[model samples]
Target: MTFDHYGIGHGFDRPGFGEAYFQAQGISAIHVMGRGDDWYQYADMDAAMATVRAATEGAVRVVTYGSSMGGYGALRFADAAGATDALALSPQYSLDPKVAAHERRWSQDFRRIRWRPDSNGPISCSARAVVVYDPIGPDRWHGERIAQDIACHLIRLPYTAHPVTTYLSDAGLLGPLIAGLLDGDFDPQAFRREARRNRSANGIYLGELAASQPRRRVATALSLARRALDVSPGNWHAQVSLARLLSQEGRHDEALSILAVLVQQSDRSLTYVVDLGNAFLHAGLTTEARAIADEVLSRAGDVAHLHAWAAHICWLNGDVADARRLIRRAVTLDAGNRVYLRAIIDYHFGAPYIAGVRGVRVTSWLRLARWMMKAPLRPEPAEAVRRPFPFRRRQDDSASDSAG
Candidate 1:
């Protein structure tokens, strides 16, 4: 049976599962009715559950599923009817007091009952329950607290809008509900395991966002990372993740501030140091970035990626020769690393450096050439070239080659 806000009870008609859900689960003999009404009203949910319970003769196994306002109704029904199980998707714990206060202007029906959490009808079910919500919802905190209190399994679907029922067909949504029903246990441990698994599956959705145009959606990623931090303030991964996103958005100062707090509370982590360097580099503070890279290298000298970042700092500081040398070292340490190889190639063949050489207009490039001639190139078995050579040939070499 399906229910709606109106008092119309209609035969349930979800093409995929309305009948199949009952038939496959051995619930075919039971009668299903859709109770369409405001279940929050005093006599509404009580009357409906009474009818269903009586019809099923106390042997009924009621599984209630609801979304949005309907979700609230389902919970009320579960509490009153002693349902076998319940599932509420994107439910509001209570109507916002601000909205309820404006009931007169919005709708006359809104004023028919109190909408505060305290005034809402109590849930009285002994049945196991599941509450699914989107963390970005306006009532997210209220929903989370309610789920926590009831010990209902909470499934946080990332990037979902206000009501998640629209995603009823989503595999990530249906697969778990089916699994939970079959398992017949909804204890805390089970909930935790399911939550973790769901989080792993949700990672695919994040990968899609990461692959979006403009390279990154810093705002969306940072918002989710912030939500994770709010849920678990001590989550080090969330904090670092937020910092990384902030750095991508060019909010380096904010990223640095977050990292500063995180590093103080924890040991010197490699991720923290690398992120700090990135933040500094994005903020146009090459010297500060180099200092961080130096500190990281002191402890992790052989880490090729760290050396590559340090080379970038050197390049930004107008030490092109040193930048090239450090980049070459980084590449030698990790030959298969495309990131370091790209940096090396950039230093060697990038348009700016090549243009400076062709135009003969950059004093820094001339100085770099002189320094390169004096410094010995580090020998590498993989290197095709053996030694550093001058950019211009000597007058004697030109005359001798001409004569020959």
Candidate 2:
């Protein structure tokens, strides 16, 4: 079933995956698509359930399948719609916060869910429920809440994140797995064995493992990241993570060698170029680093991040005058931000850099002072910046904590 589509990732099939395979097996599938907080508790619930009843009238069994938010819906609606089995990948017991107080991963989505129609409560289904999860993944934290009342057959695929369906899709095993469950012939060991063999799954698992590790364990983390790159060399996320870890370990030359190719291949993505510049600067190649900043400034329209990166690089190369000018340009581009204003003050500027302003406005300076009072997450892996943080691109998708 399709979950809420508000913040979908790349390659997510809006209709759900696997039509040909399901048809080949003579298994007809019904996709229940939800908008916002309907939770499959859609306004047309009665009609939808009646439709399901009509469709499964003579069928031997019915299985409801979904992952993440869809998993949340499938399990909750399974019994209501007379399903004989539910295959929930990374199901949440609730987004209500009241029932699932310990859960915290998808708090943003949680606020979007309706409070009255709670999905965390005990389900009425008499059929078997199968929950596939990564025990160490954040999904497990939510999955366990429903386990207290429901006797679910758990298949732990550790290190697989919330999107276990991606792994299932890659392995071409979703149809077979569901068929097995419906036929009472489900084999967890065989299924796990088959799913683990998928190259995409391995790449995801290794990359996630490397990313989740602490920086203090740099050597081991680097080894895992390298393994991930071996599995999926074209994965940009792994490339950045490896380069950053390498740079952190003072192996800047190695980082530069790896990132140089990526910078050109990526068509000078600001993130890659910034990372490349960072590598060159750290590796005692300031001239090459400065050239990269100059190239970005020369080619593009007014991009706040490009100017920010150029400013940082200029400051490093003892071009304080250019650094001051670039910082002023960055601040001009993002006017409302007090963070940038304080940077101007830190640059020893008495007046606001804008030509029309009389001086650094007292009110703006006060706003900057207020901003300094709070501890904010920034210049770190977790902070998704628009301008040049020299890390991940904060695209129109969900941000990850360790995407750097």
Clashing pairs in 1: 1-33, 1-34, 2-34, 79-124, 79-125
**Could you give the C-alpha RMSD of every candidate to the true structure, in order shown?**
23.2, 11.9
Q: Which regions of candidate 1 deviate over 4 angstroms?
A: 1-26, 29-44, 58-61, 96-122, 165-168, 172-176, 186-404
lDDT of all predictions: 0.57, 0.66
Total backbone clashes of model 2?
3
lDDT of 1 at 57: 56
Candidate 2 per-residue lDDT, tens place, 208-282, comes to: 687778868877898888987887787665677688778878998778888988887898886688788778877
Provide the lDDT at 45 for model 1.
Answer: 47
